[model samples]
Target: MDGKKAKQEIVTGGQFTIPGTEVRKMRSRKGDRVYQIFVSSPLEEPPSSGFPVIYLLDGNSVFGTMAEALRVQSRRPEKTGVVPAVIVGIGYPTDQPFSAVRHCDFTLPLPESELPVHPKGAAWPEHGGAEEFLSFIEEELKPEVERDYRIDTGRQTIFGHSLGGLFVLQVLLTRPELFQTYIAGSPSIHWNKRFIQEEAERFAVRLRDAELDVSVLLAAGEIEKSHKSRIPEHAKVLFSVLSELESKGVRAEYREFEGEGHISVLPVLISRALRFALNPGGPHTSFSSV
Candidate 1:
């Protein structure tokens, strides 16, 4: 090929964006670390009240699909009963999942001994900074988002999967009020040898007396790998704990999608999470009203 033709055909992978959507990327400083923050919100103006926002983890992998799903389902809420939302995807400035930094970002503070060990003992990256990431969202990203768009602070939701899913449970246990709704899809509760179970026990104790209101939805694939992964058993334990919360007046639900594994369940997971979190609790809440 001629030099000119070759140059013209060269494709540059720049910032990805879709029409009628805005991308917000920034690096905010905290001590010695400058964390990159990314957000994507619909171009459509929010309702008179404000836009509900869903903060997604692993944005590099799920942001485009989630945002597009939000756009389509919300376009005709009268039919789909899906409400519009500000889709805020929180991810680093990398295309790769499980990057070195996220190893530090999305995990709980635990020693190496707590790490889940396989029969062959697969090595995992360094962990134990999920609290810092939570602060980044609460103290930094939340404020940044509010400054740019009209948002319903009371309707904030956070969704996470896998290790990110572990972070979601941490958020619910440690700071339930940060978001009114929390969704953990195939969360890695087996991490740190079930550290989250201890946290959930504490949370249940607190909920016995606390008047706080929060909604939690935990979804797992019914056919999730059993031989090599703890996802199915871990999810069952979490689901049972969430049922305890549900009985205690906190709105909670769990479902196992048939014939789906960890990754294949997302399409149903994200859309169902929207309905769970965004239910306005009106007479027209269900599809029957459509």
Candidate 2:
């Protein structure tokens, strides 16, 4: 191969190989495109001890932090007694992290006034196709993962942050029964004229009879704000919506980090979020891994 081609290939497959974690690739219905999935095993000796899996969007950015946290949490099963489950990080192909495809897959429809042109260039078309993208997860991606992995299909959680967080909210509203838990961190509620607010309210009202046993955790940095403003209103909105849902008997929790900002809250909340989602009965309890 030419030197230029060799350089591209080298950069394409450069994921860190962890001992306990297994990485594999699967092709979607789209013939040539492939998706990489990473899975980690529990630290315990017995193998049949199936685990609850956490699926995180923007896997490239968050998986390492979560996998490490899971490893640490596994050492002391007493604290986390529920077996340490697998975490799946879903991301784009190596060549396409910044491609226009992510916006299409991650975002819901936005009003023309609120739309941001693709960073690639104004000429590049922006996509508003989250519904189909989510269908891919529901029909293709998830079924393959469940078929291959020894995970507890009943206790899965989907986690997303920022734009990804908005998708999490969408899924919870539309397909509330798919997962037992839904977590949104620093969700971008400003999209589509704050459409998520109305969407959430509709879900609460429509699903009044379901009264889901599912848990929803909304968290944001205490300092989340735009440069034009200093106070973070995202957390407040998250709290208000979840609080409203809670009053209706829908399980929910909201938390704020005193000093964290948008870019810094994900890692800080990883452990706290999992513990709360996994163990909701204890209104007062602290998590300290073995």
Candidate 3:
């Protein structure tokens, strides 16, 4: 092909957007940071109870994957058991898949003295805004989304990965009633000196005193090497705690994706997370490496 013809062909297309999706920007009341929200609703008519909704973190990265998955799978609900749902992706306004500013929004508050030093002696990014971020989602984002769509309030879900996954756990533990389902993929259980482990333990104690009608899916990659020794162990510990609480109305499962590393596990987890979130009545299996 001629150089001119090839260049023209490559540049012919306009920007691409997922079907049935809308993008909007809203500033958070809890902070000055503005978030780019991506919303995708199924083309089909909603169920009488309204559509279940999934709120995803790292929107720029996984919004298309999850949105398209639902679009295609929900067409064969009888066979796939995947129901149509609204997807809301919470992300920063950026062309990149993930924003460095996520560090501030996804981490829990930690005293400066308790913050861990960087392994290479470099400085860490601003962090510890998870509380405010949660407030923004609950007070601002959820209300706006509800006003725009008919949402099945009882079937709300929250999903996250890495640091975002840590924030998901924070919401589940501190405000278990906020979301009916929580999908945490490759959560940074080791963050802040394994502070989430302590939080899990505390949640377990709380579970003993009160029943929680919630479902959780915790997953990680089989070959994740950063915290190889501790991630799975911590995941299993938390899984065990949740599994024992089945009588208390908690359904939990843990899965390790085979032949995958940290980042590679995301797409695989996205598909499984959809199934788990939409079919909450399915059997809850214990720790398994798939």
Candidate 4:
């Protein structure tokens, strides 16, 4: 090959994709705003009725990891104790993190006075799109995916981590019936002076007024307490309150990964998250691996 061609090949390595999975980019417009959306779905055929679907946040990061996890575990379903399911990761189009858009999509709009101390940065991105994003999922994306594949709507699950994990809790608190199960990995519970506690109170009222059967799996690293983020302290409080929600008909439980902290815990927690999501009522208890 020519020198220029060889250099180009080196710079742009061949594209890689997950086997037996479909990847696509889409645009959603409601009002004057348009958000780039990424979706990854397994191409495998479903059972007689349909496949249970998992809607995970940060598609760019977790979709492949989880799709692969489900694929591997389902190979020996009996041995691994996991069932087949579909994974749908919601993400933006750019190779870079969609910081501004995600901030808007994943958080609540609290007044500056109510919010916690601002982080060490100038020009924060526009945030407080939590409810709007939920509407998009309920009204737009869910229907779109259902039209393409036979999904078990009754068995829907959602997973998120970090800020995304905060979003998972938002949905669980606001609309528990939307998804059958939720996996929250190291959620950002410390956000904005901990408004999640108020939200949890609202969840109790919603539970009394509505019959919502939801299962939540909470996972956090043991070291989060002492980390620079100091998030484990907040996360433990979040886990405790979520666990109390069980009395109100929500099946809330938690698993702590030893020796794992913050960023390093996702991979360790994902496999168990998938297994728990597939079999929410199963007696399987804890995950010891770090």
How many clashing pairs per prediction, in order? 1, 0, 0, 0
Please give, for residues 109-184, the per-residue lDDT of candidate 2 as tens digits. 6667676444456653565778867777778888877776777777788988877877888888778888888888
Which order, best to worst by lDDT?
A: 3, 1, 4, 2
RMSD vs true structure, all candidates: 5.1, 7.7, 4.2, 5.0
- Alpha-carbon lDDT of model 3: 0.85
lDDT tens string, model 3, 1-290?
A: 55665544456658888789999999997788899999999887888888999999999999999999888877766566677899999998999999988999999878877766566788779998998899899999999999999899989999999888888888887789999999988887777635766777788888788898999999998887455445666677778878888898889999999988778999899989988887534634322222
In model 2, the runs with Cα more than 4 Å from the true position are 1-16, 30-33, 43-49, 80-82, 95-100, 116-125, 226-232, 247-249, 280-285, 288-290
Query: Roughly what TM-score does model 4 have, to 2 decimal places?
Result: 0.85
Task: Give each model a TM-score.
Answer: 0.86, 0.80, 0.90, 0.85
lDDT of 4 by residue, 140-246 (tens): 88998899888989889888888888899888877777998888888887665357788887777666665667788888899887755566666667678766666
Report the lDDT tens digits of candidate 1 across residue range 141-242.
889889988899988899998777878888888888788888999888777535677887888898887767788888888878564666877777777877
Instruction: Please tell me which model should have the higher TM-score, number 1 or number 3.
Output: 3
Quick one: best TM-score, which candidate?
Answer: 3
**Between prediction 1 and prediction 2, which has the larger TM-score?**
1
The pairs that clash in candidate 3 are: none
Which parts of model 4 are misplaced by more than 4 Å? 1-13, 31-44, 208-210, 280-290
Write down the lDDT of every candidate, Cα atoms only.
0.76, 0.69, 0.85, 0.75
Residue 290 CA displacement from its true place in model 4, Å? 18
Pull out the clashing pairs in model 2. none
